[model samples]
Target: MRSFFRWLRPYGLVVYWVMLLGLMYLETVNNLPIPTDAEGAAFAQNFENDLSRNVFASLIEITCLYLILRPWSFTQSIGRVVGALVLVLLWTSGLFYVAFNADRISNVLGIHLLWLVVLNLGLVVILIWRVGRLLWRSLQQSRQR
Candidate 1:
């Protein structure tokens, strides 16, 4: 499993965002009826909308990915600190988005709610776990000295 993530680490955040947004675009556009004049416009609009709606979510997911992969284990303490700070900022942005866009949840309940809640909840858990792990390691290192 770790090896699998190692293979993925090089692809980084932008690749994942493109893949996520592409999948989202396909999902949204594929569900529609046959277009007589303008499915392109609709698809474009949906791509834009998905891009907008998911900006913070994408940021959060990439940070989660970095935490799970933990490449800074190969580098230095500064890398880890930078990664953690980036993760916290992205996670906080996601939280703020939810707080500001509460009504969006009801726009498509059930599955949508599950997607929103589960994804954000999973991110929160990952962020907490990574931070805890970092702190524990720091404490252990300090005690050894």
Candidate 2:
């Protein structure tokens, strides 16, 4: 276990960025409306159904990109963790929104929205664990040094 974690330490940022990209892709792709119906008109109408989901999806992608590229000062690192946690909470809330408003999400877009919620939840758990482990290891290394 120690050896695995040690190996991960050097590549922690890389792993995090990869996971972030994956989450972004999942959220963006799943939120997009894919047409399965014979009527091409329905597909066109789907995009107009609701802009909220797409807006939030874009926000998430932008935030993820900022998290990956922005140089973090000590305080900023803490803020980033907190911000990530908040985003996860918001995504979970979206799940509840979908649950209560099932009628609003009965179409293809709705299914994709659910997928995005589930995927984001899993990514959140992985990210929290990874960040916790990295912080613990960093503290340990500092003590040893």
Among the numbered candidates, top TM-score falls to: 2
What tens-digit string does per-residue lDDT give for candidate 1 at 1-145?
Answer: 9986766545534464565656554556565552333544221123335534654555665667566546545333344544555665566566557745753332212223334454456445555766777789999999999
lDDT of candidate 2 over 58-97, digit per residue (tens) = 4565457356435333221445555655776676577668
**In model 2, which runs have C-alpha deviations exceeding 4 angstroms?**
1-78, 102-104, 142-145
Candidate 1 local accuracy as lDDT? Answer: 0.52
lDDT of each: 0.52, 0.54
lDDT of model 2 at residue 138?
A: 92
Best by lDDT: 2
Quote the lDDT for 39 in model 2. 50
Look at candidate 2 and give me any clashing residue pairs: none
**lDDT: worst 10-residue window of model 1:** 104-113
lDDT, model 2, position 3: 81
